[model samples]
Target: MTRIRREVLTLPAAELGPDNPLPALRPLDEVHRIDGRERTDLPADMARQLGHEPLRSLLPARVRDGYGRTRAPRALDALVIENDRLRATVLPGLGGRIVSLVHLPTGRELLYRNPVFQPADFALNGAWYSGGIEWNIGATGHTTLSCEPLHAARVPAPDGGEMLRLWEWERLRDLPFQVDLWLPEGSGFLYAGVRIRNPHERPAPVYWWSNIAVPEDRRVLVPAEEAWHFGYERRLSRVPVPSYDGIDRTYPLNSRYAADYFYEVPDGRRRWIAALDADGHGLVQTSTDVLRGRKLFVWGSGPGGRRWQQWLTAPGTGGYCEIQAGLARTQLEHVPLPAQSEVSWLEAYGPLDTPSTGEWTDVVGAAEQRLAAALPRARVDEAYAAWKPYADTEPGTALAAGSGWGALEVLRTGLELPGTPFPESTLGAAQEPWRQLLRTGVLPEPRPGRPPGPTPVSPPWRDLLETAPATAHTEYHLGVAQWHAGDRAQAVRSWERALRRAPEPWPPLRCLAVADQEAGHHERAAERYADAFRDLCRDGHDDDGTRTAAVAALGRETLEALLRVRRTAQARSVWERLPAAVRLRGRFRLLLAELLLAEGRRAEARAVFDAGFEVADLREGAEDVGRLWNRLTDEPLPARYDFRMRPDTG
Candidate 1:
């Protein structure tokens, strides 16, 4: 028999403080633009889906970069689901990640469970952590709910045992999804059944990837003779599997830089990938055919890559590589899920036996044989069939609660979602005003001295705002909704109207500056940004982490806008106004170096680099440190600061 119980896993972690109170008005610039001209060899269907429905902006959700580098011991809520052969620990508050999967017989841990909880800037919105089996939903990068919570409850499993179900409304795509985890009696494999439902009458583009981290020393094996190699150079090219660039790529440490290898699994093959140790024991992940893609990601044996590995966890912790499964042939593509339809699939993770001491073909062949005998294709298909009936079973005995956004959506749209219930009892302070708006026809006014509530830009919310009474609150919300809909002119007008009666002009003023910047009016945008920063400073705020993060976010943009228009003095003023703690951050330090360079203070800029700082949330392909170092002197960029992803074109 299987049992599910609540527990706590404590680790030294930085508090994921309050979310930054600023709307993400600008488009996400970190999509890592791919070069299409070099990918002519891609299959017709894969290429077609690759260019379809890309993300522009991550509106509605706010930035979650408030976490600091300082860490303290803290206890995190978790759920433990165990049977006779295996045990699995899940963190409901952290995107339902399976933090630990252990085999009882050998006492071996299957996943690379990270020892620390360090939030980095990796998600579509912000703040993603490394390790564990993360269920990424919504977009190409990490899911926005990476460091957020998901509703959890215990439900009846197909074998009459209990399973843990995690559900949430993914805000980016406006879809409801659920993941059910269970370990059948005396079974060695842990099963995860996932379903994403599109309740609206319109089609939605969906992306999902189950990211599993294992020790990098192991050799990974997938059923493929070739792979689509996507390197940091932003180029996607095909190459022979196991061996590429005169070395065996199956060994994670063989490469010299970070890269992705999307295995080209042939049709009718069992969709699976495995990472086994040298002595024939490690983790293996297999899923239904619907989840077709398998990929291997490695932080290769380079200085930049090693630095990233250390930055993600404790210094002494060993590095790990990721073996992922997804819906498309590559992570860049999005599969279309039609309206009123749901995509569900079952996945299993367990131990495998295969020796890495032999040749590549021999090793993979032995692993395939072991997998076939342990959990055959028919068994997987039978599990999926059995799980389908339990997929809609209503959850019982709530174990954890996620955000109230799902409940609010259900209230507004009257959509009856079975199995995953968004009951009104889960609504909180954040959803109060929206609840009022849905009940009445107008949005409520903001409380005095507090920041405005989050702006919902969905069509239904936008329609409600358009018919509401004309107040500063409504006008500002309307402007955000209009901007998301691509109504630039109307958005500007609404912001102007908001300024007329806005007690706090900073919010609307900042928005107007974004609009001006987008329209290429740099001078006007700089002036408005300066004004907004001044207004925000004048209106006193607490010295809490949230306020400091908000101020720092605004200050960074203010300096950038001013610098763009050659308003050097204004940029200096804004930079000086930032709190001492904010100026100490790696990002702000880099910006200060830029400002010094702009002012011809070459020595000061060099000194800033010599001090040695680490950008906690540096993008995957960013060359900021390298580029800045080059501008300062002709000396080779320091190994510590060298994060250039792609080879130099020149």
Candidate 2:
């Protein structure tokens, strides 16, 4: 039998005593779970109408319905077994133990369970859902990991007038494990947490963290100047791309990239945190406890066959965000304490509309401020400045040729924009002529008498060619111009050429895919689409706008092509990768249902069709699809016809 070891850390009393500045929670026992209706104290009938149900019964019904049959033993039996195992083999050693943290070798940390409620199952809209796990630390210091019957429950409206029923649950488990499990309520968000308590007479050194999985297109930003170590062998050999897969690992204090920033606290305290997302929208924030001064163990998946680097891309179907808080490993070692000490940790989840650094500073305070202050901005700037000389030199120029121009242009544009925003009139005046020339390839040359403020050039290809090698974007744009000019062959050539010189390959690959698709080279288009998807998925963890846009664009293109080819099966498969809400839309679920019906899978098709029809009144695009659906099934239609056009028009 494998020997089980409980991981324990201790800290001194001076750093985190009872008088510590952080908010305090009542002892663990005071924490309890209450159903929403009960917490709100609604009347009996009102509570029933509100869909209040016991939390423990939530998942069994969902499991039964999902499997479409009643089992000899109730579905909750499995949960009970698992719960028992958690309590027996995992919880007792760690639960309520101040500073004693128990985690599976697989990384699932066993924490405390809510005394008031356990996981439960409920019903909504004839569908089963789960709910009822509320872990409390005290007022203003608790989190409710509930999975209620969203499909039937009426939530309070922003205006306090009416409410809406969003989604029904299927299954839920509030455990510290890394898997691609999603809740219906937080559709695009992955849920994971760690409960830390300092119960010792002194403060205990502890760092709380969550290892989140993300699609590749996302970017990772840290305060480190250089990577602490490369986890995957492949990533060590190559320059990292936004979409490269393999773990691009970082510590609390390395600084190698332009966007990296350190989280510092005054008087030698370090509270480093980082966020990840494909689009700027899905943000994951990770932080370390300043008091503990522990070092964080950060790892990510990279591209290709590397162990550590997994490039996270935005799902071709959807995306998500994550947030975590903990103590740094380094700090844990520096201040090992006696038994019975305690430490606290906190993190927040939501959209990334504002800067994460400021928020971290506000929450973690001095620790965050010091890290931000310690950032070597001057050194970073000096390094970039120093590189400019070599970058402009012949060897540097050659190295950056083709795709370099676009990058330089963008860099220059970024530098210039703040000082002198582009003139609106100039942009507007140049837009049409630029587009016209790109399309027709027939425009008058610059007049000898005229100067060069912003006049359209004749034979724009020459000027464009001059800029293409520097940036893959220029090559991609030129390729688009060629396609617009009805030179499909040239378009393909331009895109391919761009790919050869493109540093990142993504922009050109996207263009190449589109060009191939337009030229009826379906196989080639598919290959390029697949490549783009892979790249996007690998880097989907970055909290950058560009990555998000690229991922979404690639997904849209791939899905649209699959639909056009009447490969509804393929389309549906891709659609399933997206967020449930997105999949619920007409263009996805309804289309897939229609395709299923066309393929003679009537029962399955009707189920999906019915779901879409029920939501037809709620969603905008569903109405037309629903109407067409009625016509197809209720009134007989020809065996084969163009479904893109309406029957009335036909």
Candidate 3:
């Protein structure tokens, strides 16, 4: 019999600090986009879906960029589901990620269990940690819930065993989804049944990827001859698998930089991917045909890639690569789920015991044969069929609770999702103001001196705000909704109205600054940002970590805006006002160096770099450090600071 129990796993972790108290009015800035030239070779259907229902803004979800590099040992709650052959440890609060998977027979760990809980800027709403198996949903980027919680409970499995079910309402698409994990008695493979339901009356664009992290020093095999390679250069080109550009790409270390290879799995082939060690022992992940895609992402053997690996966890810890399965042929596309429909599939993860050292084809074939004997493809489909009825089973024994947004949606729309219940008991302070609006038709104001709570910009919330009395709180939230809907002019008007009666000017001023920047009013944007930063500092008591974090986060944007408009003196003043601890952060230190360079203090800027620091959340394709280093002096870029994701062609 499979057993489920709660436990704790201790690790050195950086705190995921308070969320940025601002609405994410625009999509995250990125230079790596699919341009027209890159789209020429894409299939018609794939190209069409790539352009369909793309992300515009991550609203209602605030940016979570307040995390820092400091870490201390902490105990995290975990739920372990195990039988005799394998033990799976899951973190319910961290997107219900499978943090550890150990095959009891060989005592071999099958997944890359990251040694630390270090939050980085990888998710859509920020604060993402690397490792184990993460369920990516919403859009092309990592899910917004990467650091957020998921409701977990015990539910009956198809084989009369207890399954651990993790469910949550994905706010981006307003869809409820669930993942059920179970292990059959005496079976080595762990089964995951995943479902995403479109409860709305209209079709909703959905994206999902089950990302599995495994040790990188292994040969990865996929059932395909060709793959679509997407690299940091922002182009997708089809190339032969196993060997690309004279190097065998299946061995992750053969590459020189980070990249993704989406295998072109033929229609009739089994959907699976595997990573095996030198002894042909590792993990293999497979799913039913509905999950159609398999991908391999590697941070290759380069200074930047190696630095990223060490930056994600502790030094001396082994590096890892990702083997992912998704709903589309490639992650850049989103499939439309029709109204009132759901997509469900079963995925299995377990130990592979096939010969790893041989010709590529022979290795994959042997693994496939071993897979057939251990858990057949037909068995996966059969498990899917059996799990469908159980997918609707009312959850029992609540193990963990997630955000209250889902419960608020249930209360507002009376949604009838059966297995994934968003009961009133889950609603809390975050949902309180919205609850008031739903009941009394008036959005309540925040307590004095504190920042306003999260603003919901969906159509329903927007409509409610439109009808409510136009106070500063209502108008500010209404402006956020307007901006999310792409009504820039109306949004500005609503914000201006909010400014007229606002208690503090920072909130509306910050939104207006974003508006000005988008309109190319750089000077005006800088002015507004400066004003907002000053006002935020004035209002903050600096007694609580949340307020201090807010001040530091807003200060970065203000300084950047000032520098963009060449307001060096003002930027210097802004830097001086920041707390000493905030100024010492690597990001702020880099900004200080930039400020010094702008002021023609090249020696000081160079000294800052010589002192050494690491920007913990340096973006994937960012070349800012290299660019600054070149500007300061024509010296070789430091290995620790080299984070270039591609070869330098310049």
Best by TM-score: 3
Candidate 3 wrongly placed segments (more than 4 Å): 30-32
Of candidates 3 and 1, the better by lDDT:
3
* Model with the higher lDDT, candidate 1 or 2: 1
Candidate 1, residues 1-650, lDDT tens digits: the string is 78999898999998887787878886455544486775577788888778777775678887777776778999999999999889999999999999899999999999898999998878887788999899999888888899999999999999999989999999888999999999889889999999999999999999999999999999999989999888877778899988976899999999888889999999998899999887878999999999999999998888778878887899799999999999998998889999999999999999997676677777777888899999998998999999999999999999999999999999998999999999999999889998998888878897765667688888888999999999998999999989988898999999999999999898899999999988999899999999989988885667445556668888988999998888888889999899898899898899999899988899999999999787766765667778888889999788778765554511
Order the numbered candidates by lDDT, best leading.
3, 1, 2
Q: Candidate 3 residues 1-650, lDDT tens each?
A: 78999999999999887788767888775533688766767899888888888878898788888888899998999999999999999999999999999999889999999999999877887789999999998988889999999999999998899999999999888889999999988888999999999988899999999999999998898888899998888888899978977899998889988999999999999989999998888999999999999999999998888978988998789999999999998888999999999999999999988887667788778888999999999999998899999999999999999999999999999988999999998999989999999999998888877777788788889999999988898999999999988899999999999999999988899999999999999999999999998998886474557678678878998999999989999999999999998899898989999999999999999999999987866766678788889999987888888777787623
Model 3, position 63, has a per-residue lDDT of 85
**Per-model tally of clashing residue pairs:** 0, 108, 0
Candidate 2 lands at a TM-score of 0.27
Model 3 pairs in collision: none
Q: Which stretches of candidate 1 lie over 4 Å from their true place?
A: 36-41, 543-546
Error of 2 at 609 (Å): 3.4
TM-score of each: 0.97, 0.27, 0.98
How well does model 1 score by local distance difference test? Answer: 0.88
